[model samples]
Target: MSCLTARTGRQRQRYEGHLRLVSGCIPYKFEKSVGGSNCSTEKDLLVLMISSPSRDDLVFPKGGWEDDETMSEAACREAWEEAGVKGVLGETPLGDWEFRSKSKQNSCSLQGGCRGFMFAMEVTEELDSWPEQANYGRKWLTIEEAYRACRYDWMREALKKFVTALPESRENDTIKELEERPLRPISEVEHQMPSQGCFGSHPSIQQLAA
Candidate 1:
């Protein structure tokens, strides 16, 4: 719920020894049906795009993953920081993409390349203003438009993979569920489940038997 709470003070120098790993979110929202159109069956997907601070290119929300947070957390944090949006992060990453960092001060400066983990984030809320609002501009575009507008080839590929994995109808359902509930991490949900056979011990199973 908190966006841009962490200070960007100084880039940590510790990652200078290894290849920089970044986490990012592909933020998406369901576009409402047109006034004249039937709402029952129509579902449109729109992806959020952010303008890069130093360039004219439009890119997804992404940043370096800190030592203290999980990859999902980092992706969610980046989405909030860069795009001023909050949502449920997907349990699995869409894929990894390799890119060369332009920042000379970071670890990628020496390595010349960085690995990015991309995940799907169903946008539930959008803030009026965000920390990087002055530096970045946000827009929502259709899948094809977003793909063509992407600044990096690797990112385009990631978008393609995410789209291919979830067709329009299924994606609509997923987005609806995320918006309806505050999703917990898959790990936490699994830990709370009873360790018994599917037909044993569970209340639902007992009711069915009765």
Candidate 2:
């Protein structure tokens, strides 16, 4: 089935570059992370995570997949839009885990759909400044600390895998280290169902918080 492809110029550029490299795609979306720890005598690795204001529970920076957008493209957009950070997304997927919303009645799920893919990418650059999106609370914590901070076991597991696999630091935003995989077409049912439109129909983080 053909996937929905409607990203802007820059987004399209990023998506195309990664799609050229990675041939196939995976359906059944989940959450992913690429975390590391610099723990020692002084301080531990500080990674940022957020909690939904409505639910008031900790969550990693992640979101649903975009139509035809490669894993890297979706990861970067989720990080940027949710965390307000500027960095190159990693290509090597750390891990993928499944999760369900606390409420199946979530605005998006109620109106659109609920399927998503969880993928991780390396952060190439950290912007000196950025603005936090609406109703989101962010915090920096050690990898271990993040485990306690996150609300779900699956989220903690994803973070742990990322922490173990993450490199020392962000060095290059443009260089992609992972070899490309075959790109698979998104399922037709995914596009027609309300689950996929879940977020689009309800475009407020407030619902997440609520």
Best by TM-score: 1
Clashing pairs in 1: none
Candidate 1 ranges with C-alpha deviation above 4 Å: 1-6, 9-17, 35-41, 104-109, 169-210
**lDDT value, candidate 2, whole model:** 0.41
lDDT of 1 by residue, 1-210 (tens): 443464474264124345678888788877766554454645788888887766656788888877777777778878877788887666677888767776643553456566788887778788776767667778787675666566566876677666655544344344344336553332231111111100111111111100
**lDDT tens string, model 2, 55-107?**
64556666545556655566665565555444433344555554454554445
Q: Which stretches of candidate 2 lie over 4 Å from their true place?
A: 1-43, 105-132, 167-210
CA lDDT scores, all candidates in order: 0.64, 0.41
